[model samples]
Target: MTKVKVENLTKIFGKKQQQQVALQMVKEKKSKTDIVKETGATVGVYDVNFDVKEGEIFVIMGLSGSGKSTLIRLINRIIEPTSGDIYIDGQDIAKLDKEELREVRRHKMSMVFQNFGLFPHRTILENTEYGLEIRGVEKEERQQRAEKALENSGLLTFKDQYPDQLSGGMQQRVGLARALANDPEILLMDEAFSALDPLIRREMQDELIELQDKVKKTIIFITHDLNEALRIGDRIALMKDGQIMQIGTGEEILTNPANDYVREFVEDVDRSKVLTAQNIMVPAITTNLDIDGPNVALQRMRSEEVSMLVAVNKKRELLGTITADAAAEARKNKQTLHDVLDKNIITVEKDMLISDIFPLIYDSPTPLAVVDNEDNDRLLGVVIRGSVIEALAETTDENEVMDNE
Candidate 1:
């Protein structure tokens, strides 16, 4: 189910007259610079539309001045929109009164900012329960909830410590726990890890991933880093000049970029780390174990023009593999295909990253078999060296062209 839906959302900054003129200019398809020059107004977000599904991480990403921060602020009505609708689970929050909005922010959504916004004067536990405290939750119940959130954030032992007494990463964990203490249905994180050192940032990212697995809250994460978006987002919206350029899964955006701008953003990304066996694998060439004998196996191999053929049972469960040479030898010796089957073939799970399959591909004489891990090791497809090379090379060439232009 869609947890949030934004349609034709816009936010303009300037005088009322200039904002109205800028909004008109946006509808007329005028460039942002031209609109600003003509009307003396800045478009924070213009006609941006997207949806966030329940319990999924929806990342909004762009370079500085791209209005990513503004777009996120509009979602929670922390910054009111100039036009359009912001729906949270079918309610148009854009029209909500002050009290209604406050209740929404209190119970349905919570925000975590870039600057670890923890109270310096308060203990970590107290800081965590601050939201609940303001909402008039009973002291004992709020404390219990705060302690649970802190434990979940891996900051339980540090609950007694103040913000200044902890590392930057620990302080950020407190901010996360604070957000969790309210048990909001949605999390709005605006560059929550951007302030940390690289190592600490990665650790926080990992922790968030683990935390999400446990809590399953719908997260709307804002970031300027494409890699971070690709790593954490279930889907990503790439923005520029207050408009959404494209929205898709990481693999979709990488392999089939919407435009040259997106191509440029992904040019330097390591495709091996992003691409997986399932992304490039072709259908497995196989022969049935019960029905097909050595002669039939050889014929199948000849027809497919492959050196080896995978053998499967009636249910398509992988039994073994047979080489052309083995099949021919078995046929000559009047033996069944199973008698010459080789069970030592290299295999990779369908979800295994291409980088992880390099060693297996290098050592295997034939293409690496891709199997469904959730299934009974059923053969899904095969990933040849050529296929892997071609997938990576194609993106590189496209990216280089984009960069040159």
Candidate 2:
């Protein structure tokens, strides 16, 4: 389901051209020389259109003065549009009256800003519960919900602490918790982590990703940072002055940018690291052998000329993996090769980014299998630590080239 949709939206600020001209003439300043010579108000947004899918992390990205913030605020009805329509869950919010707009806002949307808008006098718990309390939720229930929200935000220990008592990240977490506590259908975040330091920003980014994995709320995040948009958005809408330049999935935009502006914005991103097994896996030969056999496995390993083998049981469920060293050691010990084989496997799904394989490469006991998680134990390919490091190096080189270009 589409959670929010905007169509032909436009916002114009300041006095109209004709009015300004008439006022200038009356003040004996000047007469309008021509309509083309007349300057009207600024257009904050122009003919903007897009739809946000339910449970998607949709991002609106642009440079400063590009109307991203205005668009978000307009969607929440904080600012009225000059002309256009906004639909939330199929209802045109642009048509809603004062009370109706308030009702929709109360029930359908929550927003987080870069500034943590916590009440200075209120404790963290109270701040989190403020929205629910305003909506007239019973005190006990709202308190419990606030506590759960704090726990989810990893601020349970600071429940009684005031906003000033916490770090910037913690305060932002509280703001997020406050938004989530309302359980609104949509969450709008406007550069919510932009004010934090680099390390804290990355921490918040990780926390937001983890939280999204669990909560999966429909979010429309506004930001000017390209890297941040790529990290968090399921799809990105690139905006210029009062207009959307392009809209596409991250990979689509990265690989096939709509114009030179978007290309330059993403040109320096490490393409290969962003690639997953889905992008690089190749077909390979395999053989089935008994786990109790030794001589047969050695002959098979040598004949295949492969360094390792993916292990599976009779049902083809992934059991473990075997390496050349284990096979040789087993042969020397006069034991079944399976006896020396590693039963632990560090692996990734075919759909995951190759970047996701880094921790496993650093931490795995053996080479990791790239499996098609949708299918049971189906081997996509295998990735050793060396291959991933090489990929990283290549990506670095590619980035350097892009920079130099």
Candidate 3:
């Protein structure tokens, strides 16, 4: 189910008199520069539309002035849109009254900002319970909730300490704990980790991933870093010039860019780190254990023009692998294929990164088998050396073209 849906959401900034003119100029396909020159109005966001699913980390990413921040603000109605609709849980928030909007912010969604936003005077526990206090929750109940959130965030030990005493990452965790204390259904994080040092930023990213596995809250994360987005987002929306260039999973954005702009944005990314065995593997050729003999295996390899063939039982469970040379020798000896099976076949899970498989591929003579983690290690496909090279080479060529352009 869609938790949030935005339709034709547009935000224009300037004098009220010029807002309509700026919107008209946008409708006429005028450039932002021309629109600003003619109407003295800036378009913060333009005709944006997308949905956040029930429990997904939907990242909105772009460079400075991309209006990603504005889009987030619009979702919670922190900034009113000049024109459009913002729907949450099938209700149009744009049409909500002041009291209803307040309830939505108080109970349904919580935001985390880049600044950490922890109060200097308040203890970590006090800061975390602030939201519940504002809602007039009982002191004991709120305290319990806040402590639980702090524990989940690994900040319970420092609950009595002030924000000044903690590191930047810990302060951010306090802000996250505060958000979670309300048990909000959706999380709006705007550059929440961008202010931290690189090492700390990575730690926080891992923490969020681990937290999400347990909490499964619907998260709308905003960031300027492509690598961070690729690491954390289930799906990402690439924005530019107050518009979205593309929206897709990390692998899709890297492997199949929507246009020149997106291609350029991801051209510099490390493909070996993002591309996985599932992305490069081709279907494996195989012979059956129930009926196929050594001659059948050799014949299959020759017809497929491959050096090796995988062996599977009646249930498609991977038994092992057999090479044409081994199969031919076994046929001459009149032995069953299982007698000469190469049980020690190299295999990698579907999600294993190409970088992690480089050494394994180098040491193995035959293509590495890609197997499903469940289903009794069923053979899914084969990852040949050429396939890995080709995947990397294609991205390199694309990047070089982008550099040339």
Highest lDDT, which number? 3
Candidate 1 Cα RMSD (Å): 2.5
1 or 2, greater by lDDT: 1
The C-alpha stretches of model 1 lying farther than 4 A from their native spots are 325-340, 392-405
Model 1 TM-score is 0.91
Candidate models: Cα lDDT each: 0.91, 0.81, 0.92
Task: Give per-candidate clash totals.
Answer: 0, 0, 0
Ranking by lDDT: 3, 1, 2
Candidate 2 C-alpha lDDT tens digits along 37-73 = 4655465777799999999999999999888999999
> Tens-digit lDDT track for model 3 on 271-365?
88899999999988899978999878878888899888888888888888888888888999999998888888888999898888888998787
Model 3 earns a TM-score of: 0.92
Stretch of 10 with least lDDT, candidate 1: 390-399
Query: Please, what is the TM-score per model?
Result: 0.91, 0.77, 0.92
Structure candidate 1, residue pairs in collision: none
lDDT of 1: 0.91
